[model samples]
Target: MTVMNADEIRKLLPHRWPFLLLDRVIELKPGVSGVGIKNVTISEPFFEGHFPTESIMPGVLIVEALAQMTAVVYCTGALQAMREAEQEVAATAEAQLEPAEEIDISSRVGYLVAIRDMKFMKPVVPGDQLLLKVKIGRSVGILSKVNVAAYVGKVCVVEGTLSVSQRP
Candidate 1:
């Protein structure tokens, strides 16, 4: 089990503020599954245009959040596998990467190529804490499908399946 804070997430993801939807990754199992948190607040920039009075969080953004969470799981798993392979090569070779050299995971990209059966069950509002969960379903080469769901206080706000393709 690997838990990633915002900083660690930043090191792995290229998304920045306003677009970086995930606040924290509570539980992660690399490519298998992960659970992430996104604390919605009135201060969110999107709320300004999404709805002035209602302050409803957009459904598309929610899906984007879920996708970002999925990326974390997918990328971390890939990073771990590469690291393990590096260790194996080091065992046979006397020279390896310098002490300061490390993998630059932020360059990785995951594209959301498809969204299926997505339903926005409830309108998300400010002050709500979203619980984002994703599990890898199937994969063919660099393309992978994921089961995604989002909840707020145990109420399912969104659920769907997303197909993502990775880019080097």
Candidate 2:
């Protein structure tokens, strides 16, 4: 089942056209793990500069796609936590919780802090559909580490570990 389509993804992420690499999320388990798809086409803006002669998707962008997937995982978990907190606050009768500052979660963007052990096994080009997979690792404070991998068909194109931090 599709957990999130492009429109829903846009609502949760700050990225816009030409920058938002994720197309659809097929599997999602909040902060635990997720899998996203990116259909690379000739119309992609990056292809224009990445290579005029032979269009090849940049390895960095593949890493970015992985990072974006990680963001979706973490952000969705945060949003759900917020909702649960709100419900708990509402249930309290005599003990009233202080009003928390309202922040627009939809507009929030997470930063990719570090990428390690990245391996680009194959070149991604037009018509290639990438499957981005992310698994959560140990987290410290607001920073999280995720094991990320991108696959074209059954072939692994890129694999790495990414460190991401949510904005305050």
Candidate 3:
């Protein structure tokens, strides 16, 4: 299992501060599965608007955290996809998480294909550590399904299925 620090994550993803929801990847198994952690802090800028007096981590951000980890899983399969495409573009491409990594951000977009049965069992607040675990469900063509669950210790705070379709 390869553990990814913030710097390593920067090399593999295109998210930045405020938007980069995950802190580090604790466990990774390439194409199979992965676990990531997001440390929620009172200093996060979003708290200003999310709630002034009693700030709470937004559900959207929690989902994005899962998506980011899922992206890692998606990237692990990128090389294989390139081979199947009989394309050499990815060969010279260096991995980086900056938004600029994608050649056409406007034209080629990563679409949120679907989200099913999302259940928020508890709330995640500042000082809480969100443990996100993602498992590959199935992939067909350019779409991949991932099962995601976020927990704080033994309590499951959120769980859902996220589907992302790659524009080909």
Candidate 1, which ten residues in sequence have the lowest lDDT sum?
A: 94-103
Itemize residue pairs with steric clashes in candidate 1: none
Residue 156 local lDDT, model 1: 98
lDDT of 3 by residue, 14-72 (tens): 78886988788998876668999999999999999889888899998899999888877
| TM-score against truth, every candidate | 0.93, 0.91, 0.80
Q: lDDT of each model, Cα atoms only? A: 0.91, 0.90, 0.80
- Which candidate comes out best when scored by TM-score? 1
Candidate 2 whole-model C-alpha lDDT, 0 to 1 = 0.90
Model 1 lDDT per residue over 1-168, tens place: 338888988888999998999999999888899999999999999988888778999999999999999999989988888888888777778686666367677778678999999999999998999999999998999899999999998899999999999893
The candidate maximizing lDDT is 1
Error of 1 at 17 (Å): 1.5
TM-score of 3: 0.80
